[model samples]
Target chain A: MKQLKTRTEQILATMPILAWVAFAAYVIETGAVLYSYTISFVDPEAAKDVYRGLNLYRLSKINFWYYTQAISLIAGLAVSKAVVAWLVIRALTKFRLENPFTMDMVVRLEKISYAAFGTWVLAMVSNGHLAWMMKETGELQGNWISGEFIFIIALVYVMSQIFRRGVEIQTEHELTV
Target chain B: MPITVNLDVMMAKRKMSLSELSEKVDLTLANLSILKTGKAKAIRFSTLEAICRVLECQPGDLLEYDDGNKK
Candidate 1:
């Protein structure tokens, strides 16, 4: 069991790095998109050609409200993803296999769950808005609320409860000498 | 919390030092200190028996129930 736990910890140790890389990639992509949008706004003709090449010219023509909403949605998702990645990295760095049932782990699990849930809700709402916008424009919008994200949220919540129980058991065992 | 360890009292009565008791009982000083200082949550029967044998006292001599609210 101890060997298995160590192996699991070793595997999980890489997850934070993966998450951080994903977050960095998302930031870069978002920055490029924002830069493109800015150029499009500054020079519509030039931007139109650029956007057309990127297949985002239709989105560039959206109303002010929709545009702001889309930006806010993207920003929200990015911020939450970054926060989750940061927390996961911090938690994993501090994690000790010898004593895994700490309050820090519980807090980290709960925070991760909150971030996942927030991401799920934001994705669902933003996807709905996108679908509505697409219907108005006679375009098809892809589904954004993924089952994997929902599963992650649920898994984190369950893990948090499990950690809570582990903490209780550890305390009892310690008290028992 | 109402049940307190009287390990110190028993050790004192037996004129046994912590180290001596530890060596006799084949337990660590830290563990004995924990028991003496009433920090131990529970004592194993084997440990209790060992301590009792060394101190020449019963388990009751090393443990006491004091109701703070009654006082």
Candidate 2:
């Protein structure tokens, strides 16, 4: 990725670095969520710590099991997002500037798109779970799901399609005299 | 493909080895193999000209179009 063919490609190499940073951020966020969840269980009073603008730990006072369930759902969503971020990092690392269009790249891009779609689905499920939990215990707080992933999924899916076509065109070009 | 390369047929008729044709045409053996095997997606006018010149064949002799689902 550090190859210096042009200024544009030099800038392109920075994309992988950004993706790695994003991946690290997601990993750290996942760790923080898990740490908070664990701390909340150890000290029920610490459940008062607000996370994602939601006083989810307060639910522990109403119903301990339900609070655990809510926290678990949130953790699951976090892990799914981290997985998606890791997939993005993997795709970025595998990407090549020289002879970039290949079947391998198409497959990796497709995998990343699929992973993003899965994350979106998990986000929807977690959003529904949070709503249901709030209704069951009469606690409506901040939003757990931002409508961000729809655009992400669409963009990545479209990128994968473009890469697939690129692979086809590159193959045709290589085979042509 | 409906359109196909017939480089091997003309090569055989001219009694030229792939390497000999490649040397005369100044094309790589691999490219000549691709054209001969009909694996090439397209041929350039320059390459077709070189092959035709070496094989003493017309473009029609080096390429053919078969209607229907022959491929």
Best by the TM-score measure: 2
Q: Which candidate gets the maximum DockQ versus the true structure?
A: 2
Restricted to chain B, the TM-score per model reads: 0.93, 0.91
Chain A TM-scores, one per candidate?
Answer: 0.82, 0.83
How is the predicted docking of candidate 2 categorized under the CAPRI scheme? medium
After the best TM-score superposition of candidate 1, give how far the Cα of residue B33 lies from its true spot, in angstroms.
Answer: 1.9
What residue pairs clash in candidate 2, if any at all? none
For candidate 1, the per-residue lDDT at A105 reads: 94
**lDDT (C-alpha, whole model) for all candidates:** 0.75, 0.78
DockQ of each model against the real complex? 0.49, 0.78
lDDT of 1 at A73: 66
* Stretches of model 2 off by over 4 angstroms after superposition: A1-7, A39-42, A50-54, A140-143, B2-4, B64-71
- The number of residue pairs in model 1 that clash at the backbone is 0
Per-prediction TM-score to the true structure, in the order listed? 0.82, 0.84
lDDT by residue (tens digit), candidate 1, B1-71 = 88999888887887889999999999988888878887787889999999889899998988899889874
Error of 2 at A97 (Å): 1.9
